[model samples]
Target: MNSVVRETPARRELPLPDGAISYLEWGAGEPGKAPLHFAHANGFNGFTYRRILSGLSDQFHVRAWDARGHGETTLTADPARHRNWYVYRDDLIAMAEDFKQATGKKIILAGHSMGGTASVMAAAARPDLVRGIALFDPVMIPTAARIVMLMSQLLRRRGNPLADGAEKRRAVFADRQTMVDRYEGRGAFRTWPRGFLEDYVEGGTKPREDGQIELSCAPAWEAANFRAQGHNITTAARNLHVPFALVRAERGSTCRPPFPMLLKRRDPAAHVMQVPGSTHFLPMEFPDVVAKEMRGFAARLEREGR
Candidate 1:
């Protein structure tokens, strides 16, 4: 059993193969109704969905797990697990098994970025454990995404990519209001709340003896993970015998090849929708929209007896 007690509405923990896995579990409703299992993206943790989870907790059980390197999970002492991509997937697999054993039901796999890719991989490997899948801007097009991943990896041995300045790379604010303000000002941080960065920083860092915080998941590990992004989603997605849906942000990068459009166009079974006025971080950028779409998708699957 998971030796975890809820610290906040957004964070939870579970004992996995290696150690305790920190996660963000949401939604209330009744028990045994097929919960939505969420997964976070890179440079962010599960609590990034704080506001989003609060609104959806009433209708469905929304659960998000911190990947091997983020949130309360760590890899500083024994870097072996975070060093490999398969370790993250293996941790997720354990989470699925734990949830299934506890609830006696499969879940609706929902993921973002790398988490989205991991969701696909998990569903592909354990179809019986997944009734449906919903992915948000998962790093697709194994080639390009892999390049990005490799670039991140290359930066690991060299130095922190964002070392030049924290103000440049990704986030715009250290505080919530500051983030919201800069979102419109800088144009990159829009739609995301302050909690996203807070949770990300909290989950991604560990205390150092010299009072410095070191990244829990090494940049190299993250790079290696990204480099392996091009593992062929088409083949994996095609073999998906379950219902699947995709929610893409209007301004985000593509996770798959452009041909997926025509391919999905021909395969009418796969449903895809665009979340307008949103960025790559659908859950963070637009939680209400994400919840509304996810609820509808899950409701349809439930009706179909999935």
Candidate 2:
């Protein structure tokens, strides 16, 4: 897949209440074909998944968007305020609605990390807009940890460790190439292919007047995402009525499958599988596997005709 050159996607933007949401579309599907809509991980934008989405575009029309405060999407008013993960869910719901109204068909939701979590909430809230969901290691805290997470919010802690760490991130770089060089095989980006890393640096950064580049998504906003995790997945999972497929990473994943066992129990058709030798960054490490899982999900939905 890495050897093949992919086509550049057309950029588009949508109007929101406070600002506009930006996205990329890979293919054009006919009237009856269900388009696939993808939400990206926290701190990362839709362009980061260009390789994976573009690969699947041959069979499925693909659209991936940047979350609020990420990529080219304008920063929300008062970026510091994020009570919970529901804001992202709401944003996704709006995007899904807009997409459906424009295309005249429901869409399949596919996402990783925060994107996956928000997808679940969107599907639950507006089942009419979503045909099915394919989640890749969405962040789902266990019952015990969820209680503590909510308690910390109630307690009003002094500083958010994640937010603080994000504030300390180096956002300015000499150039996009410099950023790519630094992340090519290091830390969280160790498993990413060189082309994917290049795509991330090129699409996720904007040139500054000083002849340097800075991250489009503010570090503070990324930190805020880490700090906010109060979405009630238990309810969302139970409420989801459409075909659902989840792929979790085997090692150090934030999403634990059993947390939403009720979905499996309620609908025996729902599928959940943990990918061995994968971590929180499974999509980046194994794009083909992620694509395969999503394809299988679409096939299941087609066979079930739900």
Candidate 3:
């Protein structure tokens, strides 16, 4: 039986320009406990990982934020002006800095997919604020592919399949159950464990003035995130000076070949592992595994006095 106390995280918001960055926090502030900030994947909210974060609450101060254009974050998300994922990196850096100033302690940065990639970038840029990093199948495209995508962006070409799909995704639903009924066991959500899907629906949607619930992340902005993949994550990974751990999915992983290999080569101390029979949604499918890895990583960092 799982003995970890699963506390319902408290919802909070960090003020930012034009809007606030909404977040969910767990664990009481205990002396000597290192803070861990978890970022969510694109189109997902912080509440989506409540089980994992809540489980870690006993060991570390756990907090997860809804990125701009996702969840209840009121940040300006003009897809037309968005260029790359750097905005996410910058936002995360700001949050880390704010947390550090408030608590007077360095933080552990962790995330899934886009959130993971952004955490890497932020850690590389400001390692002083981050004690360590934990990533789950972050989207690290090959250098060649990044170059090709850069060229496409430079040419102003649009219409990525992922982006197109996001744009066409159903945005409005009568209620949470209706949304859950539509996404319970289909497509990318097929591997999601029970209650995770319901949490996603709860956090990923908002009540509109029309008495209907709609996706908190606008379809256009989600599509924009899919298209804006020009950031240099390889360089960011290579520049890590702090301890880090990476969990890769066995199937449909965005952290493709050569990236993880090269990351290990650059930082032999970096902990990288691939879970068998796991998909990109590994955290959702195997929350216990993800939580265990995170707790172990954070424990190591604490033992090292980081």
TM-score of each: 0.75, 0.93, 0.95
Write one digit per residue (lDDT tens) for candidate 2, span 1-306.
432436677898888888999999877654455689999888888988988888787777788998888898873834567768888888899889888887887889999999999998999999999999998988877667777866876698656666777878889999988899988888678888888888888778998999999999878778878777667887888788888888888898878756657667756877888878888888988888888888898899888775
Clash pairs detected, candidate 1: 27-57, 28-57, 71-203, 140-255, 141-256, 142-230, 149-226, 153-223
lDDT against the true structure, each candidate: 0.64, 0.83, 0.88
Report how far residue 256 has shifted in candidate 3, in Å: 1.3
Give one digit per residue, the lDDT tens place, for model 1 in 194-266: 5554555555556666655565555544544544443656656656566777888788555656634733653
Model 1 weakest 10-residue run by lDDT:
163-172
Q: Where does candidate 3 have its weakest 10-residue lDDT segment? A: 1-10
Put the candidates in lDDT order, highest first.
Answer: 3, 2, 1
Best by TM-score: 3
Query: In model 2, what is the error at residue 268, expressed in angstroms?
Result: 1.4
- Which is superior by lDDT, 1 or 3? 3
- Candidate 2 or 3, higher lDDT? 3
Residue 190 in candidate 2 has what lDDT? 89
Question: Which lDDT value does model 3 have at 266?
Answer: 61
Alpha-carbon RMSD to native, per candidate: 6.2, 2.0, 1.9
